[model samples]
Target chain A: MTITTGYIISALLLFGIGMNGLMTCSHQLRKILAVNLMASGVFLILIVTGFGTDGSAIDHVPHAMVLTGIVISVSTTALALTLACRIQQRLNRSADETAEGNDDD
Target chain B: MNGGLTGMKKRKQSMKGKFKRKDWQFATLTSLLIATLVTFLCWAILKEPPGEDLTAEALAPLFVQSGVTSPVTAILLNFRGYDTLLEVMVLFLAGLGIWSQATVDPTNPLVFSSPATHPTKPNFHGPGPELILATLVRILIPLMVLVAGYLTWAGGFQAGGAFQGGALLGGAGILLILAEPQRISTIPPALIRFGIVLGPAIFLLVGVSCFGYGGNFLQYPQPGAGSWLLLIEFGAAISIGITLTTLFVGGRPDPKRLKGTDQP
Candidate 1:
């Protein structure tokens, strides 16, 4: 019933929606979540593109790629979050120091 | 994330008379983790099995070599081998990147606090049941290790392969981190380094080995299913281990130090 274009559109929508949130969200963690959402959506589309019509599959290449992609995405996300945590720690430290300065003022 | 964060224990000891150490935690992580879980649930509800046929199609010669069935080993070692090779490199790069980013060394045990503040969580409710932590890892690590081994070997015939098997192994490491971080330190740096770099290095070596025979890169002449498959899977195990470990811990778990060890 569904077309490849439709699959693509769904994937794009997922990515776009998540991207909007990632770009706009002030919360650091929310940005990470949004990125994750976008990644999932993209993988979904990749999977859809690789599907066969009735019984035969169109392409196995994409599926294999997606399999690899999923683990890579997960790993990248973990690294990104680690960065977020580090940044958060730095920000918190400066904020505390600034608060002390303002108290003196 | 809700517990065990002490960045400043040493200096705080000097000023302990005035400042109280407190634990701080954001309640939001649990919510985010839950949300991620739900999203995965939805995906599972709608997921399709990735066909072996798909992989077969890819490995089947595109134009000239269209007559024969595409082999999994062929794809891994040939057709899209570039992908696998680069993927291995990515793992290596990630480790190097994280290593470069390390502010401290892994050899140091994470101390109760840093030199500044007392070891206290502002939001620490209580501790996890210590017995549960120890017992859970004791049972789970072995089972997980077994499953990881199975995934690596079973990958040749089943829906799972090197990546899934590798992921399972990586998951075991993460589980160990969660249940008993003390054990994580005992794993040597050399082993970790070797394991993380093994996949790409070995993959490259294999490619070169084939190249020496006057063939293009990764064109292993050994087409027999049993022997070739074993070689490729072994490579997968190494790459999976390296990639997943670095990714799971975001490069490495270089905790804060106890400080006095610098002398010894």
Candidate 2:
């Protein structure tokens, strides 16, 4: 297979795997990781799209778009991670309170 | 990690055991269908012919002429600058969200009004970094700083840009924070707020200024586009660095709340 086709196929497989993981995973952290994996797959596709065919140079627009995508994805990931941490903390705190109440009984 | 993996495996096994035969059959069928669809899509891509290089031929040259030698930088900071501006705002908004979630009560001045403590102390019982990590950070910070500066400057002509430089700077900041998270609290809130907003604020101000000059919004004054682009990149790098570091810290750092309570 041509290099372009190879790259595209790998990226597509990555996207499929990531989506499957996202849909099937029960854990929040794993879901986040799946999302990140999906993002990386998209990034790869974007970069590959910039690749020139027939000896032409790579496209700069897609490169710029990928850069912007990377930054935005990072922000989203941070926010998601923060939410996950808060949820875990709240869950643990409630569990502790329940344990204390049971001890009193 | 091995224990966690095994625990997860056990849970998955128990969950599978609870599912009926029909449920398992359906799930297997769905997965097979999805896999077939993905394979077909890949095959379609492989069968497609190579397309024209319109981006390289038409857009790249125009972007480069905007007083920046690097086409990607020119596109990011000039040709499609609105996207970059909004991207910074995305990061800024993330910081704002984290700040809002911080336990630091804004109305309570007592918690946030403390003075700076010594920087060397480890405040949290959270797993401390190894001696090797500390030594690596000490040796690498200056080099990272230098590389970041170089990347920001080289963005005018080469493959580097504000984002790359900012990421490097942010990495350095995160390393330091990991060594002593409480030291993050030593930074004044006002300064942190300014750092988070600076990039978007400057970008908007510049865009608005163009309106005053009767040019289209975000159009750099024709004569000094290079200098204008550089200034914007510098502001953006600083803000991006700050925003990334704040994200890593996971909360708005309050110097007033630090004081002696930060010590372990």
Candidate 3:
């Protein structure tokens, strides 16, 4: 297979791995990581598509789009991580309260 | 009581085993489904015919008019300015959302804690930041700032831009926070708020002002396009840097800490 096709296949594999992780992992942090992996795969595919076969000039449009995508992904990941931390903190607080009640009983 | 505790431990072990088995099966099924979907996607990609290169051809002719020598920068800040404008807003919104959802966890050792307040808290990470790390941060932060500025300027003609520069600045800010979290609080909250809002505000202003220049929204007049792009990039890089650092800080600043009334 050509090098370009090889990259495309690898990118697909990455996406598949991420999807499997997202579906199977119970941890919120792991799920967020999986989503990031999926995004990376998508970005790779866009870059490869922009890189035309043999004698063609590199496409700048996809490069710009990828840059934009990267920024958006960072924002989303930060927000998700914050939400996850909040959830964990709340869970821990409730667990502590339950343990205190058990002790009192 | 000992016997009861042992019985409870055995029950928990058995329950964990059952859950593990279930999880293994679920993982296997999900992987299989994902594999099949990926294989189909790969087949489709391979079979698809290559399309004509319309964008590159169109972009080539208008590259000069877009103001920046770098095609990517020109496209980002000029041609597709709306995407960037909305993107900055999204980043700002995320910062806002995070601020609203939670406050900085005081228990986190990464945050500044006075010896008097957290005397009982074990130093799990280390004996705290070493002199070597402090010196390294001191040396590197200024350099990072300089490089970030260079990258922003270089974006007009080369492979560097506001995003890269902003990221670098963000890294420097994170390093500063890690080294001395207390130092971050010394900066006025209002200034931090301004820094976070600067990018989107400037971008919106520029787009609106384009109407006076006899062009559509975000359309720079042909003669002064480069300067407008530079201005936008400068504002965007600073805002992006502050926004990223704020995101890492993980919550809104405490008013008491900002006012310097709270000891530690």
Top-scoring candidate (TM-score): 3
Better model by DockQ: candidate 1 vs candidate 3: 3
Docking class of 1: incorrect
Q: Estimate, for each residue in B94-121, the C-alpha lDDT of model 3 and write its tens digit.
A: 8888777655533332442222122223
Worst 10 residues of 3 chain B by lDDT: B112-121
Q: Compare the candidates by DockQ and give the number of the best one.
A: 3
lDDT (Cα, tens digit) per residue for candidate 2, span A1-105 = 678777888888788778777776669998898888888888988888888777677787889999999998999998898788767765655665554333343
- DockQ for model 2 equals 0.61
Alpha carbon deviation, residue A58, candidate 1 (Å)? 4.1
> lDDT, candidate 3, residue A9?
92
- Ranking the candidates on DockQ from highest down gives 3, 2, 1
Per-residue lDDT for A2-84 in model 3, tens only?
Answer: 88898899899888888888899889999999999999899989999889767787888889899999999999999999888
Task: Report fnat, model 1.
Answer: 0.14
CA lDDT scores, all candidates in order: 0.59, 0.77, 0.83
Off by over 4 Å in 3: A99-105, B1-22, B105-129, B257-264
Which regions in candidate 2 have their CA more than 4 angstroms from the true location? A99-105, B1-30, B104-136, B254-264
Q: For each candidate, give its TM-score against the true structure.
A: 0.69, 0.82, 0.88
Candidate 2 structure quality by residue, lDDT tens digits, B1-264 = 999999999999888777756566765776677699788987776777657776578785586469798888989999999999999899898988877765431222112211221222223444556788779988888898899989998999999989999999899888777665545555677888888889788878888888877889899888778988888888888888889988877765543444445442
Q: Per-residue lDDT of B115-170 in model 1, one digit per residue for the tens?
A: 33232333322354378867887888789778877876765555655676777777
Query: What's the number of clashes in each of the models?
Result: 17, 3, 0
